[model samples]
Target: MIKNLLLSLIFLTVLSIAVQAQEALFGAQQIISPEVHDDASVTFRLLAPKAQSVQITGDFLPTVKMETPRGTFDGPGKADLTKDDKGVWTYKSEVLKPELYNYSFIIDGFTTTDPNNPFLIRDVASATNIFIVGGGHADLFKVNDVPHGSVTRRWYDSPGLGMDRRITIYTPPGYENSKDSYPVLYLLHGAGGDEEAWINLGRTSQILDNLIAEGKAKPMIVVMPNGNVIQDGAPGEGSKGFYKPQFMVAKTMDGTYEANFKDIISFVESNYRVKADKSNRAIAGLSMGGYHSLHISNNYPNMFDYVGLFSAAIMPREDATGKIYDNFDGKLKAEMDNGYKLYWIAIGKTDFLYDANKEFRAKLDAMNMPYEYVESEGGHTWRNWRVYLTEFAPKLFNQ
Candidate 1:
């Protein structure tokens, strides 16, 4: 009996090993193709390991759709998956429109990738493959001979967090030639992003230079700062999303951003030739950065005269009620009404935080606060933030 039991146990262990091997072989799967012209139609092909249910999700279709053998996926395009003798699955889809899109494959309840596409972007949780509908804007992605701004990375000693932190600064046209001081805009990046995001991905400096050259925007110093707190001796420490337990424990929503604000203000005032007055200083950011700007500016009423929040996340008003006045009552009345020169909020209609932005706007209206609210075409993306900065900059320093 003992011998028989040992043999059965060995057989089960071998079976487990085989199953694990099959799973590992599956890895991540995806489809590949480039963004085609708007008038031209193109096909995208995806390869998978086995016969599994796969769906295509992209900016065009924010939701997932089943992969069909030869039918359209219910939008401007369609997808078909076929299998070859080698046990590889292939899927093809027709070209739709032109725009920057993010897409992925979902297999057996897990998000996978198309092994064929070389374009990808790294986020906090996973990497996503990118496909452009048409070619991207030349000014934003490519370096040009036109006057441009430089993005510099600066490290500073943070006494509050007991570690060094980094920030990205964008100096506009004529910044180097003149001894005259310029107004500064402190731009904060969202969660899962670093100081480099606006400069690298958003093309902030280029957009500003082009806009200013066209007389559409005012030339100013744009400082993009890393909002994450680092402890002693910790290298590359940062916060990306609110899904992690540490992020929640840190109460990223809780008004701790004053530490980052103080560091940025001190660094800019001491190191750069910028106008140090509240009227000349502005603050703006996207998502988590938007939340930070709202809290920080309100808490320090005298620090910034202009404040912009793109897709701002207004948290629950602390009283578990639907009233915004309960939480921001005193500050909303005292700081935003009298202290700010221009308070602006811009958000897309499809953004997840649209409702919260609307509610906050209504609260500001009730307090008779003077501000600007703008709604545009896209969701939470750099596409919208780039345009937001272009429009918002021109309105600043006018008084």
Candidate 2:
């Protein structure tokens, strides 16, 4: 009995020490960096007594113009944070919209994520803290009280690429339980992104789950493949061990990916219970993925009935080769003659590729090709891409 009491005391002492250590590491007081107010305004806080200057950069703020080799486009805005006597820096915004936003803290010229905010998303190599201001469009992006879908990281052999590659597939709710076959949407990622891009930063699964549960979108399978042909998968996911991801990867826009896309389709149709016909098939993507969607749909001519280009790169690179990149007029004409359910194109007003898209549209007009165009406010951003998906998915397989 004495030994038992002694052991109990020791356990209590160890628990107390652990609690004290945790308190010392993360402070005794809880710090809520992002406090959303009733009026839709958000306030951010950070505790760093030794720091001289602190600034917050987020998508909610007005965009700043950035000049690049491509063209001038808008980038995220930054604001200064006021420090109190207690060494806590705080910044309050006027009013934020009901959409998801990502932000980072800049301390003494170095950029860092908010320690207080646990929710984070990684795009390429950079990681940012993300939060959704509920009650509007972001509602679909949230994981609400709805029937969730299954996201699987599957691998398949690519005979064209000559390597086993990774793919992310989203099977809708009631998919596994029921033997009902569903339509498939071949959703591709942008240049720097891999198969994991749409699942993570794009919030594809959450959006699909909420939309499908609400009956806003039909239950369908979404297949996201890595556009970069050189790599088997996303960074650290392939043979490479945790290598830094870059904004540019090799063989993204080349004809290689478009030529080998059949392998992905074959894998999906064979593995999953899908309606393996053109009328029940849809293909869409953003930027380079968009370019691929355009070319792939045209090349196949009878594969996808619905095609979407969200801020797509309109043309191939100057030095790009391959028959897939050749005879664009002939390919598009063949696709138009074959007929499709919907040809949709969406782009931001200030997007650098806006003019190129306009030119592409004019070419379509010359051929009398029918296509739907949607122009939103922001330039080359995930916010616009998510919005596009919400709008695009509903129109698929409806006809």
Candidate 3:
């Protein structure tokens, strides 16, 4: 009986090993991914013979905001993928419109970046691979045969924060050669965004380059500053720069960023030969940065000639934690009295923040404030933010 039991156990162990070996086989699991065809359709391939299923999720996918009791959000579905005989999964998208789009691969039930794609971008907690659909309005964000500008990572000391902070600066093509002082645009990023956000995710440099080359927008200096109140600089400046836990603990929504706005202006003014009048200085931001721009322009009503809010996220009056002006309407009126150029507010029709923006627009109307309102055709994604910047840039300092 003991001999028979031993033989049976050996047979079972061998069967298990055979099954494991079969499962571990990866026949066709790696290949060239995301090949764009001449007709503007895209084919994506991934090798995962062992995986049971895969799918693709991206902003390029058709977005239909389905209404739910909880709230509204992007599409409830993703593009399904198919597997080939080589164990490689593949997908082909219909001819996409020309625009920068973000996407990721969903293997089984887990979402991940494409291993074969080298270009990727991270916004706060989410990361995805990026691809540009060409030859349409997307041309504005593409690198054309234009005189490109230079982007520099620089630092400045903030007396209010009591530390040196980092900022991304963009100098137009002829900035170095000419002695003429240029107008300055103070661009801010959203929550979970840093100085690099405007440059990396927003593609500000590329947009500026293409716009300036086409003569649709004037050449200027763009100062992209970090809006995080607690951190001294972006992730690479300090010794523990990569330590992101600090970001969560750091309190920014308060009046800290706005109160310290003068420091940034002072640094840029003192260093660069920028046109020093209100007309030459413009401020704009998206989301949290929009909140900052609104507050800063209000607080310093005479500092900037133009203010832009791209899907601005506004908190209810009662929930405002920090020093919001007692009378925002009065403040905005005062700024307009000082001869403002543009008060541009843009938000997508399907944006989650649409209600907040609409309420604010109503307030602006009630106050008889002069502003430009653009209701576009998308959601609260960066795609809208980029479009806002493109539209807003040309209208800046043109007066």
Better of 1 and 3 by TM-score: 3
Pull out the clashing pairs in model 1. 29-113, 30-113, 30-114, 31-46, 31-114, 192-240
lDDT score, candidate 2, position 385: 97
Summarize candidate 2's per-residue lDDT along 1-399 as a digit string, tens digits.
999999999999999999999987778246787988989999999998999899999898889998887668798889999999999999999888899999999999999999989899998788999988998788989999888999999999999999999999999998999999999999988877999999998999999999898898899999999998889888999987689888777777768999999999999999999999999999999998999999999999989999999999887586468789789899999999999999999999988899999999999999999999999998899999999999999999889
Candidate order (TM-score): 2, 3, 1
* C-alpha lDDT of residue 229 in model 1: 48
How many times do residue backbones clash in model 3? 1
Root-mean-square deviation per candidate? 9.6, 3.1, 7.3
Arrange candidates by lDDT, descending: 2, 3, 1
Error of 3 at 125 (Å): 2.1
lDDT winner between candidates 1 and 2: 2
Q: Rate the local accuracy (lDDT) of all candidates.
A: 0.67, 0.92, 0.85
- Candidate 1 overall lDDT versus native: 0.67
| Candidate 1 structure quality by residue, lDDT tens digits, 1-399 | 999999999999999999988776563332335434455444445445575665555555533333466232322122434556654554444555544455676665577666667767654445667654444443433345678766777777766656677777888878888898889998877766667667755668777777777676677899987665432211243433234222222334445555356876888889889889999999998888887888778767888899999877676634223122235578767786567788999998766677788888888888788888899975667667766876788888877
Clashes of each: 6, 0, 1
**Over 4 Å off, model 2:** 1-20, 25-29
For candidate 3, write residues 165-242 as lDDT tens digits.
Answer: 888999999888889899999999887888888999999999999999989999999999988867767665654556
